[model samples]
Target chain A: MTIAMTTSPEALTACCTPTGEPAMSEETASSLAAQFKAIADPNRLRMVSIISSSENAEACVCDITEPLNLGQSTVSHHLKILVDAGVLTREKRGVWAYYSLVPGALDSLAGALTGRS
Target chain B: MTIAMTTSPEALTACCTPTGEPAMSEETASSLAAQFKAIADPNRLRMVSIISSSENAEACVCDITEPLNLGQSTVSHHLKILVDAGVLTREKRGVWAYYSLVPGALDSLAGALTGRS
Candidate 1:
């Protein structure tokens, strides 16, 4: 695989270049597509939404699962997808993995979709 | 089969309600997921980016294929996905199908991803 994301700011530096307007490059298209694919799943989308609007804008896997009315494993699986997509970052405190929105992840994605800087 | 989309304004009316940050509901998650799914494909993503940045914000299938170096059938398939995702609106003028970005489609998607109004 080409790895999940660019993993560096330099990757996206050209993303917003060309000013005013430009066609999305192949790299940009693939990168943004991967991120969007992460949110493309209903389960992952639900999890990210819950986490984004949660208290402190972070949520433990346990807290996220209950309202979802889904099995623990399924929720975890979905969480993995969001984390892979770079939309959510995971921090393990003790036995729990707490997920929080990666700062600017949504804005970057929104920018990509809107062709904004 | 719940049809591809909600197909009603009432469906998305609740999309932006519950302001000041709130957990995304199941309906909201699914609807947004469906739209995201449309942009999830690499081919489709390339096509949308090309078409979105094209002259007049619209492009015929013929105009889209050459730059991407992809075959006509592949481009058409990608276009179908974007159309199904509600990102591109199609207008058949003579023997060609012309596609234009839906006025608020990108904004609506950006709003959903950003949780913005």
Candidate 2:
């Protein structure tokens, strides 16, 4: 595989320096883009800040709506996006559902942005 | 201000625990969301990977289009978005423009996401 790659004329291109950094695949880009898109909204980011900074880095949907002055349904929509993106996890306790950071999600994304990945 | 905050019942809310983490403001969220939104597309992300992994973490408009099989105009559009968001900066020399990450831009965004900011 290395021999085959080294033979390609593209190997000589500036994009393919021997930095051991492979260009991101379309798949990787799509997945990461989805995560980034999920948090690309201002209100959604506020939701993340509120939840991540909450006690135990988690909070209930009911408690989340008021501080941000958002309605229940709107907060839920943002929370759902974060959960789907793997940035947050949800747990149900009796009548209330709580949300918290998925742990290291942002750090990994940070690594990707700086090419540390 | 400290006394005023201590007396508010909302301060007692779980969203406002004593962790010293302030929820992201509308302005901060809007600015960050723009940066995140710029990179939220797959093609844009691939462009970022190609440039970031390049030698010295920078690349030219000419060299960038080929790796992703994108036309000049599309790549230019993506580059403009990145530049406008302050994630990447563009410098023109002679006939070519080179782009590089705004130093610590992604790190700071990462910090914002993890509430480290």
Clashing pairs in 2: none
Off by over 4 Å in 2: A1-21, B1-21
lDDT of each: 0.77, 0.80
DockQ of each two-chain model: 0.22, 0.33
Candidate 1, residues A52-108, lDDT tens digits: the string is 777678877766777778898988888888888889999975456779999999999
Q: What is the C-alpha lDDT profile of model 2 across A1-117, one tens digit per residue? A: 355453366643534334455669999999999999999999999888877767788888866777779889999988999999999999975456889888888877877876565
Best by lDDT: 2
Worst 10 residues of 2 chain B by lDDT: B11-20
Q: Of the native A-B interface contacts, what share survives in model 1?
A: 0.49
* Model 2 chain A: lowest-lDDT 10 consecutive positions: A11-20
Please give each candidate's TM-score.
0.79, 0.81
Global Cα RMSD, each model: 16.2, 8.8
